[model samples]
Target: MEKYLPYAVLFLRIALALTILAFVADKMGYLTQAGTAPILWGDWDIYTKQLQAILPFIPGNISEKLAIVATLLEIILALMLLFGVKVRWAAIGTGIYALLVAIVAGYGVGINAILHYSLLVISAASFLLACCPIYKFTLHGIKKRSTYHPY
Candidate 1:
């Protein structure tokens, strides 16, 4: 179990990054998969509509802009994690982003089977990942061992 830990952590990191990317893509109007089914919403609509639909507390005028900001933040954290620059801190940021997402998702959609649980669980998992100190490809490790000052 210990030997495979790095691989497992890497997979989780990739999964979270991909998840963030997909959300960002949907918002950017690139990955449209709405299909012909009227039940499904359009990819372009995900940016503003989903937020409005999920979180009524947010004002309609600023929802889209706030979403864009959130998306960019998520992308930054994801990239940091993917590049192994600062896994621990990036993971914490990711977790915070996920919580923000979950706050909207959970309350907007209500506590349902997959919808609410998925967001909450992913946010929680990110927090858990942050607690782990076994980052394989990260600058955090090097920083820990360095006793030299670059000033």
Candidate 2:
């Protein structure tokens, strides 16, 4: 178990990076649409209609901004996780983001969206596992205190 700790951390970091990188790539039009584009589902007209649908409570403009913010954050979080910087905080943030994605997809897009939500949850779990004390290949590994002690 101790001997393989570094490999485990490396796996987690790479997995999280790949997951988010796929999302970003898809958004940037590198990957073809997997399902119906959320904007075409209704009267919505925007680069990202899923954002508007998921955040009905916010004004359309604000919702668009929020969506952009969320996307940027995810990308940043992915990069941070890949580098193993602040792994504990990144894991917690990833978990919360995954939960939010699940809630939004559940409310706006129905059961089909759950698949994406589940992937996010898995990514979050990976990050959480990487933050464990036994995983010692990360940038945070040098810290004397275990930041992920709660988990």
Candidate 3:
């Protein structure tokens, strides 16, 4: 288990990075149609409407902007995780983002969409665990610092 720790962390990082990159590309209108539409497994319009309904505090334009920001943030977080730079903060941020995605997709949409979100959640969790003190490989593992230290 100890010997494979670094490899495991690398694998999780790669997976999360790829997943987030794909989402960012899709949101940037490079994957499909060129628009500010929300990407959904089913009907985009219906999903957007549901999102608006769920998050009524966000105005229409602001919600679209938020989606784009979220995608960009995911891409950045994924890259940071992959490079093992600020691993602890990046992992925690990604984990929270994954949980939000899971909640929105699972309840707002359908179970099928939840699959990918759940995978993200698991990957984020793995990275988070790898950053923990008990993990065999991490920046923390090398430096042996307390959790309060900002890397």
Candidate 4:
């Protein structure tokens, strides 16, 4: 059981990576389902409407910019996790980002979605995996032993 722990962590890392990527794809329109326009609106376009609906104090353009930046951050974080470049920090950032989204948008949705989307949980999972990276199948793992000597 102890020996397979790395594999388990790797599996969790990959799962979180894929999960984040799926959301990115949805935002990028590679996986938008029909009739979701009423709810999801499919992409960064939802940023304006959602921000306005939840926090009307923010300007429309600022909300749009936030959406774009958030999307980019998600993309970067996903890539880092997928490639195992900086899994720990990426996971932490992912968690923080997801928590913000959960706080702002999670409230407006149904209990099921709030739970299902589970960004906050995703955040925790990613961060946990970061603490014990397998690195057996990752590019970063191959280059050299990670020098992440946290103080």
- Taking all chains together, each candidate's TM-score versus the true structure is 0.75, 0.74, 0.65, 0.81
Candidate 3: stretches off by over 4 Å = 32-57, 116-151
Deviation of model 3 at 94, angstroms? 0.7
How high is the lDDT of residue 12 in model 3?
A: 72
Residues 24-45, candidate 1: write the lDDT tens digits.
Answer: 6655656656653322334656
Whole-model lDDT, candidate 3? Answer: 0.63
Tens-place lDDT digits, model 2, residues 1-151: 6768667767877777777766676666555544556412222233467677666778977877776787798898888878877776776677677777776777887767767436556656755764576546565555654423334
Best by TM-score: 4
Which of the two candidates, 3 or 4, achieves a greater lDDT against the reference? 4
As a whole number from 0 to 100, the lDDT of residue 101 in candidate 2 is 75
Alpha-carbon lDDT, every model: 0.69, 0.66, 0.63, 0.71
Error (Å) of candidate 4 at residue 47 is 4.5
Clashing pairs in 4: none
Pick the winner on lDDT between candidates 1 and 2. Answer: 1
Collision pairs in model 3: none
Q: Rank the candidates by lDDT, best first.
A: 4, 1, 2, 3
